[model samples]
Target: MENFFDQYRDEVQPALKSKLEEFILFGYDSVTEEELWQYLCKKKWKREREAKLLYQIVNDILSVKIGEYMNFATVEAFKSPDWFGNQGKDELSKLL
Candidate 1:
């Protein structure tokens, strides 16, 4: 059982690290490895749910960091015309 958990964590760490990089890119300066681990655990390690949870965390952080400037009602504002898409938007756009 112990090995199973260890191996599982090892398998997931790469994905978690990638997600953590995205969080850091969002200007979430306070996020730590432990916090990312907690977020993964909170999602029970489900991929889709974990992605949604990460998005929520990023949005929540943005809500605090950008305040009233964070909300956008337009759908086009959420999308990108180029191949990069919304995922390619930088931290500055998140603030805008």
Candidate 2:
């Protein structure tokens, strides 16, 4: 599924840029085009079973809200093994 979407990277560049700009305007300065693309590929479009029209992809990118992206990012962060690098289970539990 991801391989199928990889072909649309260039075509969707503009929409990704537009969405990144929107995020920046809302004070999410750390957001990047690559991260936005990842969110779409991994979260927003993860369950897609068929090719989407270019316009549909563009709309999906442009329509993403900061909250949605943030939630996705937060979940991804928690999923990363490095998020708690070197921490013992007890230490992690204490932090939580």
Candidate 3:
């Protein structure tokens, strides 16, 4: 059976590649793609402010404090798919 990361790569990674690339650039050639994927799984960056979220990971690697904010548009795009999927749905409707 495929592991979580394996499944994630096959499913989510293709769609998320560009955003993941943006995160990888901060690693300065030292961070491997696998490492970034592991980190994403560990940190849940997709569920929240991913740019700011990415900054936290990058900052740890670089030993610098930066990337304090992300604009609304980026935040909207970065939220977890589960969160976005519920945006137009009503809880009461689901309950009925």
Candidate 4:
């Protein structure tokens, strides 16, 4: 019944937003978004660099948004905490 964003939005977006905001703002919030982001990422400090970082952050948000409904196929089943159920086992076994 739960959708993709619905599942991960609650889990991923907040953390991503917080990290991105922190990555942009850090301990201080006096500077503008463009200024802070460049200083943090150590980019070219140009208009385009700022714009690119902004774009990447938004794109990361989308990835985190969809990743909520997703599962990590690379992780082994027996090594995973939630692997006791059949949901991850069969899929993982097929990979090995």
Report the lDDT of model 1 for residue 95.
Answer: 73
Q: Number of clashes in every candidate structure?
A: 0, 0, 0, 1
lDDT of 2 by residue, 39-60 (tens): 9889888899988999998899
- Candidate 1 least-lDDT 10 residues: 65-74
Per-candidate Cα RMSD to the true structure, in Å, reads: 16.2, 3.7, 14.3, 16.5
Ranking by lDDT: 2, 1, 3, 4
TM-score of each: 0.36, 0.82, 0.31, 0.20
Best by TM-score: 2
**Whole-model Cα lDDT of every candidate shown, in order:** 0.45, 0.86, 0.44, 0.40
lDDT for model 2 comes to: 0.86
Query: Sort by TM-score, best first: what order?
Result: 2, 1, 3, 4
Q: Per-residue lDDT of 5-96 in model 3, one digit per residue for the tens? A: 44335544443455445545776344345654545554444354333433354443333212421232246447657652554457746766
For model 4, the superposed segments whose C-alpha errors exceed 4 Å read 1-52, 64-69, 73-78, 81-96
Off by over 4 Å in 3: 1-6, 23-27, 45-96
- Which residue pairs come into collision in candidate 3? none
Query: Residue 72 lDDT in model 2?
Result: 94
Per-residue lDDT tens digits for candidate 1, residues 1-96, read 122123345545555566657656878556565555543343334344333344554443333322222232123236535745567567548778
- Could you give candidate 4's per-residue lDDT for residues 25-74 as a string of tens digits? 54433333333232323322223422344455445543432222122212
Give the least accurate 10-residue stretch of model 2, judged by summed lDDT: 81-90
Best by lDDT: 2
> Using alpha carbons, what is the TM-score of model 1?
0.36
